[model samples]
Target: MAQEHLDRLTAVDASFLVQEKESSHMHIGGLIIAEGPPPAYDDLLDSIRSRLHLVPRYRQKLAVPPLESGRPVWVDDPNFFLEYHVRQTALPSPGDEGQLTELAARIFSQRLDRDKPLWEMWLIEGLSGGRFALISKNHHALIDGISGVDLGQVLFDLTPVPTQFPTAELEPWRASRTPSPVRLISSGVLGAARTSSRLAAAVLRAASNPARAAGVAKEAMTGVADIAWATMNPAPETPLNVEIGPHRRYVTIRSDLRDFKEIKDTLGGTVNDVVLTVMTAALRNWLHSRGVRTEGLELRALVPVSIRAKDEQGNLGNRLTVMRGALPVYIDDPYERHRAVCAAMGDLKESKQAVGAEVLAGAQNFAPPTILAQASRLNFSTRLFNLLITNVPGPQFPLYVLGRELLDVFPIAFLPENHAFATAIMSYNGKINFGLLADYDALPDLGRIGEEIEAALAELLALARAERAGASGNGAAAPPRIGAS
Candidate 1:
């Protein structure tokens, strides 16, 4: 029992469990289209329900004992909270994009009940084009991005064939059995010892190499200073920073990965670099068209960098850190902006940004839940960055569910305080799907940003193709011209 409790606690800490006030929920919003008539959505729901019963982790809840005596625990309840995790809703008349987006916003704003498992799946139906949507919101405590993706594999079948889930019953005494006090004390001691050892080692390592340690300390101080500066001098008040109601607006733009690859290949940068470059160009044009003069405007965007291993797939939680970079909106020349973005990203990659994020995540593991949660809230509420941009890599091959071929997949990133808009880009089945979530009031014309993104990519694609044509003499290798679909 003590071992089980410890394991659960480690899982929670590993997931960076949010404190009560801080909103640490990450959303995995997918826009799935069924080729044929929608299959029994209830049947899929039942499959999930049955599977949840088998996974003890899903049935576990946050247990805060009497204030004076015990720490939080993860005790399993005999009667699982299934309803708290799965929900079904139907769209109103006309069932258009507008209606669906409004519903999604409402869903995003609401917090998940903490007493039960932290996750919810909404099976939405009623689309004009005979399409339905499945939006799943899971607490960051459940899994990181890789784990979340892995959970999708568990819940969904690659081949359209449905499989049976385990439905074995456990003994009645399972829920009532609590960890023994002795065992709990021993486990706590061991956890404390491990933490102490890590701290001691870090100190020793720092002492052994004074110069290297000094350099690391300098970098840490610089990072802290940068964060402090950002908080003191808030980012420019753009349309993205404002009060947002409990309303969500979603818009998706699909582009071929091949087109992006062509641009990357021509430009000598990663796919992400090209994507950010395109985003900068789009924002430049969008703001300029709105009569907002582009001066020394540096839009700080939070780019989520995945920290999962190459082989570790399908675990969900937020195993990511925000890489703050200045979007070169002031650069009048699109080509110059792209080059500057690439250089900026290159510098960030060379720095210890990723390493620092992992270290910060490690620190959270030993931190008291309350302190960690407060820190998270402060970090986000401080406007550390202007907006969020996340890029999640999806399965390269086609994925099927209950014999239905997935037409496309879009990821919806949750909005934090001060930053009302988030852009999530996911690549699935040869195409890139960009989903934008904005506070309805602040970004009333958020949909226009979607159009801008498309236009920017098209511009880059054209430039890449023209450059290829000029170099290759034969136009066969040139990328296809992009046009409005």
Candidate 2:
């Protein structure tokens, strides 16, 4: 038996599984652009394969013992499935936006091999711009969004020079070094006694303060109820919610962070506020173009927030909570949209949604693991939100691998059933890169959506710039008009 029944799945983990569809895997996907000559690609692959030995978990497979309920577990599998996880492919002639989007759709539709450690890397060549793409997928249970970003650093080198990564022996070698079971049991008993004493002291402290204890208990109950409410409610049916086949469409858009910052600096809000504002505008335009018009059509988005501590970078395993917020898609004015998004986000933060998730996470410790896992799946499957939007922060400095400069980085997130699309934005160096993964059949024109996103940002930036000029008593000076393509 596992050391703890609670180890089956954390509440957050269960929620993801419940929402998972055949088209969705809770894994994070990344695109690394590298300038390459065809032959040099082999060298890159060799370097990556050799370094795989350094990350022991990469070689392990998900195993569930017969005594357990067959829940997935990670254990070393000496005879691993390597080829299934890593692959090499080339795009069709002149790999432009259309070809890239097609490739993304194909990649998103396929499921990872669950029998192995859930991860894969694809090296894509033959881009119109003479750049190659590295696409990687890893199981969500293995790494959350923040940790996934950290893992990128491990694979990439900051310096242009080649460097050797640290390596460790296989699990079998380590197991051989372990002491006998008798010694292990003796040490385990002593450790358990110490832990029990500390737990007892903590409980006594809580009991000594009846009023404070009662307040804490009440808060915990409320948090659990809040999470339940959020998860149990089916997401509103939208264009995104439709039966999806095994097909993925990938599209990307890039913008200078300074341009976005300029808008926020003038608008008086954070970068995320600008991002949401732009998305809201684009969504409204897209829906309107599709003849789907409504008054106050509030779109719910599942925003992922990192729960990792400052020191937890590069460490794997999920550590995140979803915050559902209503996007004011009904609004037409750019400035109004910006204000509305900011206000809504501010309210969400003030409401302690993140704290509630933390409390719910804490409550899981007291519940039976199996019960919690079941409850979690039920919550997510019910359509807690209409869509997902995530923002992952990355290193500001340029990253390189074997002297290859990384031009861009994009993130791909799983789209749950009944949810049409998931958008992930990441800041690499000085640029904000947007990656959109959608159900191919449901979102046939995903590339158009990417274009809409660009236009939306441009619209907002124009408004912000004009507003700044007017505020500076330069109304007589005509604001620079944005060019129409």
Candidate 3:
């Protein structure tokens, strides 16, 4: 029999599967709000149906080998149905933000079905101010933040006028037949043989050039050492890290992208640096609200770094590593906080943290499924970081879905075991939106945290403006010191 059609999950991708639990659902997606009336359910399905070919994995489901012979593979879901995946729902008339947030939180708390495709899209209507929203949920094993697809990217158009195609012009899709158990086993065996061949080829190349190979090996070892050191030094104890339940609460904060840029240009470092600084300040205040002292506390953030090349933009699965970033909540002054973050982030970029993560993940390519599971657990151990902070850059200009203008987007992040909170940020159309997801019981004050984030950015922006005025020799007095009572 010909080799059954199959694509094995990468070590990084399969790791997400290993990390999932009944309470910890390893899925990452976003909440998108668009202006104008909600599109008809059938019309929306048609739009997605037309573009399913672009993302073939949407129609595919996981297929594990018999007796754990190999890692899971992606196979066509012969029972794939578009309507089942694309759902339509609505809140009561004139639904407010609070109501919508409640709806999203409830939706996010539920896990995606494993037997079918690992994604869902809910078209929510009835928001106050004549708006509609979409809440997407895709298993982390399928997509990462860097290469994640918001339905807008797949269904939206650049202009307000959407592209139109006649119903007759659209072609129907048919999933390939599912493979038998015997075929799955045969494919797993072939896959192992191929992995062995690749390793052998690498050894032959290394032997041909000992000096070059030695240098490469030395760098890999250095990266591994860095990872080991991070693992040994467990993240600091904080209220953010706790035994979280399955339920979740979500809140959003929006800011002008230009404000972040201004801080970067005037105070130095990149926008991401500014983001971390702001988050550090917010965490400081939040901890204090819980009556926890923040003196000399340095929290670690599991910042995921994308290693995907330009040519691999739209490809599915994860191509990313992580860095244990420092959040120096100890610093009180805003400028000092920003400087510390900038310096620490700069050092992390130069360090082998990401390289080490990539090297470790790469080794799993040749390992058995059991070994892969163990390695993945080590890679995302709770001891490694206090919380997850992912910053994904989005399209600067506006996007439209079926002639409706996209107003705002808030990205959703998943929580690992023992992590009570995670923050996901996305910049779109000149606005930086922060989506805060936390355990419903642990963070009943999630809305307060969102307000704190806004206040943090406001303070930073004020300081930046003051610095600019001082540089211009204006007579305006300096603003009050930040973090001062």
Candidate 4:
């Protein structure tokens, strides 16, 4: 097979790298729990070794061109050591989920070493319920949630029993000769030239039709301005929108898929709407518990929308845009909250806020690294959204690790500055699991948020049931399920 050229990071991908700070870690990962007695370290190592060929990015390290001429590229790590990337550790005796989560939070607090492949997997043993765990972490620039599908598939088996993958036919990977520094610099120079030429051509082509060019320019300018305004002028500040530190805490809650679908079907909202409504209620309850006023106020969440096309399934890096969510938490009625959330989301979809975010993210491609890095600092310098809520789809089938069936898996949400909390959601089999990230200093009782989510979901489900009965000629709808049970 022919050798591939250096794979440079895309603009949005590079932004994640540039946006990194000592106070905020930008990597994403999952804290996974599997049924145990745990698999042997050697067994887990062998499993990953056999599949390493499928993910070349795993073995490659970050390489930046001289003078920051272009985005960082992926190059073979000549000193790559598989054992270092795949680690083994035992949780203390009586290793309950709480202890395991504490360990995960510590790991999440630290930044990945840029010297090697920006990923790691820890095999954790000694959970209370006869189980072990796989703590997976990867840099945001290396893989988005959609692009990380292969990683999950490679590490898990569909059945409780492991299946053998054919390895004999696979070609061995040998480190290619590293290009000279002079060559790398020259490549950057030429790449910059081509980029410049492309931009010039695009400008000239658009300029050929003055009126059309003006219209396009206006749209682009408006999009950039709108995104800036949305980021700067977010909803009324809340307790969750405070400055954060490096330390982090994580907690998770899960909902039944059938339950969510039933609510969606009966309440006349999308699954996404139901999910947002749940968050609205949980956030409202959490604030009210903290003695914060929640009357007639709304909280804004920055929700990410994936723009990756179906054909671009296997490619790594960021391919998503942010959309604003105005969650009406002040509403006392669960049905009213759901309806408002659904309407707001519909408007957001039609408003093209995500398109504007994409346009803004793409502009970073032309920005010099210094300027881009500075922009990142500014972006995180001020408060934007109260929370960054993200939901990614996962395989609905069961997954196993060395015959240890996975009971629950939750994605880690990396918190940005001035954002004390973030939420990540993923669906698998028949459950939708939500992971919460918060500043350790700000929210020591992060577990309460998880409980709140369950409570809120229950409330919404009851409302859906009431709505269903009313439609069936049962009389006016039951009173809203809110406040105390």
Candidate 5:
């Protein structure tokens, strides 16, 4: 059966598209270094080819309506060629960690071609050790699942044994004639009319149930108003925000997830609090090294919160909202910083900041694609938030591809316009991995920031261990107090 209805991009997702520019590439990706006896490049390509049906979006290309009439839609690319997207490459002779990081950074700096499917998979071989790495990239619009996070979990299995995926029946490719100009305009008009009708219906229903509708409307309006008012002030100017170049530099940081949990469990704060505490400390140090004074400074961070339900794992696309978090940049003490972050996050949660922001974001669904894109650009150009930091949890158990044991997984997140640095955190097995991305020229000392993160975490971990030891020596284990919702 030929599909008739177009798969359109939601306004929130379209916002990402409009926001993307030469300096800022909006994609979420990961670098995976696997263990010995690497599989042949052909075998890996075969594996991905066989499973493309399971992820139909992989072969679909974007179709923008005429004159930006409406949001873009997903259309099967009749000229889809798997080899163009899945590539093979070899690292320099005596491939070492240094060379691999450089290679990954260069690959990440290049933007994905919007004309084809917005994704790529590089099968890299010839490492210093008998190992290989897979660098995967996908546009923010494609894998924008809950919280706007994904390392392509759908492409792997839980164990090293490659489970044979039953071949799913796929639709054969058949090119359709291009839509007429009249057809595109009609589509846009229809979309707008539908939105208007829904608004009218909502009003009528509210009029019928005056009491219930008024209550709901009042609450929603209040939430949106509070969020808008709170964000009117621009974020503090800092070295972290600057004019960025088209090139990007990548850095990775590693730590045990248990260390973070240990600190949170014993210190009476959430895991996120501990993470922020350490991140703030590192950011403070990094800025100080750049000769910037950090006294009485509070850097705002745009943190993504996913509203997708647990069972909606396989359904991709953006279902995310933003939370404005105030990082305590002035606080020098690690424990004090942790407490401050916990308190601020707790308040933000209580205020339902994300809820209000989401309500406002939902309004975009009724907006035109052009208008939505420009609005996002405005937010990016003006330093609305100091930066973005996201922590996504990966599988604790091992995942494999073509019988290869997946080792480390580091996620490289998007850096918006004028925003020079961003961090994407992911924890797998026993380790928490951090991928730091920065403008290649603006932040050449990016590794210094990564080093600080590691150093700060190490300091906090040592303190937590000593504290836990003291409590154990004195009495029974202290119960953890819950704070954030």
Candidate 6:
């Protein structure tokens, strides 16, 4: 008999699986474009096969105990086939970004099969330039934004020449025999007991150092209060929040990272502040275009903050918490809007929102599968935020897959029930790419929002230049145009 192996899912990771619904898929990934001719499908397969050992979890699938006695565990998939997870497809006619976006939307619409590993990579050929795109989707239960970035290092090479691993160094793999129902139940009970024991030990340790524990407890309580308040006070209803169908529309916005930094430097705030400002401006204009009055309107964005420590860089599963970031669309001036964002974000950073979220999420560890499912749903209730906005930092240098250089990356964020719009941003190789996913029917004007984003950037850039010129008392000394190096 093969060695029996089992790894239980963390509560945060398990939440994603329970949160997934027919209309709301919980997969997160990106649309990646690379320069140079596409690599042969067989060669790409061979490259992935060699590096499979780096991410052993990818070869495994989930196993739920009989009657859902405990959270699912990761077990090896005996019939694992590389071809099934990695697929190849081509666009028809002269391939362009529009066609690719449509294709990506369709691919993202379908959820991964429950019986297989929760991920897929689609190698798409036939683009306008001598480049190709890869659409990667992984269940949220499998990975989060920070860990996903780590996965990139494993899949892509730093230089143009690809790294090769000799098969002699790597051993063959085999799946352990699947655990029977009785064993699963017993293991679940034991796991629960171990968790309780660990928690009790932590509590005892805290009790020993009462002063330190008191300070931590106070901070946690404050954070919990903020989170509870946010939950009770529902965000204002907007065109962006409504019943979402299974179909989606995907749009991308290309921007230079320098523009954001310039705005931040000229206008006294962080790069993220500039980003939030642009988003707010775009939302204001989009709402107006849709005949909605935007007086005194402040939309809320569910911003995910990564808590993954440096030591846990490559570990999988979610290590994130959410905060309700305010989007002050009511501010008419771009600079004023940016200032408001900076101030609000600064306050949020100092507050206990994220800490409270972590504490609440940790409590789910003791919850049974049924309770965990309901609690997970409640944690992401529609009243908490209007839309989701996530920004992930990436490597500054170029990355290559089989010598093909990765040119651009547009990260995709999944939609929650009744939420029609979400934006995911990734800054790579000096360029910041925005991927906007929307409900196809609810957002036929998604392209219009993309246009508004560009317009907002231009407006902010001009203001920043003017401010710099005034500060320096020389117009020529102001920063060059946005795209300037």
Number of clashing residue pairs in every model? 14, 3, 0, 0, 2, 0
| C-alpha TM-scores of all predictions | 0.82, 0.85, 0.95, 0.90, 0.93, 0.97
Residue-wise lDDT of candidate 3 within 1-485, one digit each (tens)? 22347998888898899899888889988899999689999989988877787788999999998998988899988888889999999999669887888888898899888899999999999988989998888999999887784434766788998876564665666677688898888888898899889889999999999999999898889889999999889998888888888899999888899999988877888899999999999999998899999888999999999998988887788999999999999999999899899889888877788888898988988888899989988877888899999999999998988899889999999999889899999999999999999999988988778888889999999989879889678776544322211
Off by over 4 Å in 4: 1-4, 160-163, 196-222, 378-381, 473-485
| Residue pairs in clash, model 5 | 144-317, 147-306
| lDDT-better candidate, 2 vs 3 | 3
Please provide, for model 2 over 1-485, each residue's C-alpha lDDT reduced to its tens digit, 9 standing for 90 to 100.
11311123344654554455676556678877876643265676666766675565676655433333323344555456556677888888878756865776677677776667778888788977777878888767777888877777877888878677443432322211223344334443444455468668978999899899888777756756666676666566678667666677788888898988888877767888888888888888777777888476878888888888888777666777667777899888787777788888887776666768777665543444366666566534527677788988888888877777788898888876556688999998999999988877788777778889999998888888778778678546443322111
Candidate 6 total steric clashes: 0
Instruction: Assess candidate 6 and give its TM-score to the true structure.
Output: 0.97
User: Could you give candidate 1's per-residue lDDT for residues 110-143 as a string of tens digits?
Assistant: 7777777666787787866787777777666565
Query: Which numbered prediction scores highest in TM-score against the true structure?
Result: 6
Residue pairs with backbone overlap in model 2: 105-248, 105-249, 240-420
The residue pairs that clash in candidate 6, if any, are none
For all candidates in order, the CA lDDT equals 0.68, 0.71, 0.87, 0.81, 0.81, 0.90
> For residues 395-422, could you state the per-residue lDDT of candidate 6 as single tens digits?
9999999999999999999999889999
Lowest-sum lDDT 10-residue window in model 3: 476-485
- Candidate 5, 198-247: lDDT as tens digits: 88998899899999997887777777765676668778998778878788
Off by over 4 Å in 6: 474-485
Candidate 5 — worst ten consecutive residues by lDDT sum? Answer: 145-154
Count of backbone collisions within predicted model 3:
0
Error of 5 at 266 (Å): 0.6
Clashes of 5: 2
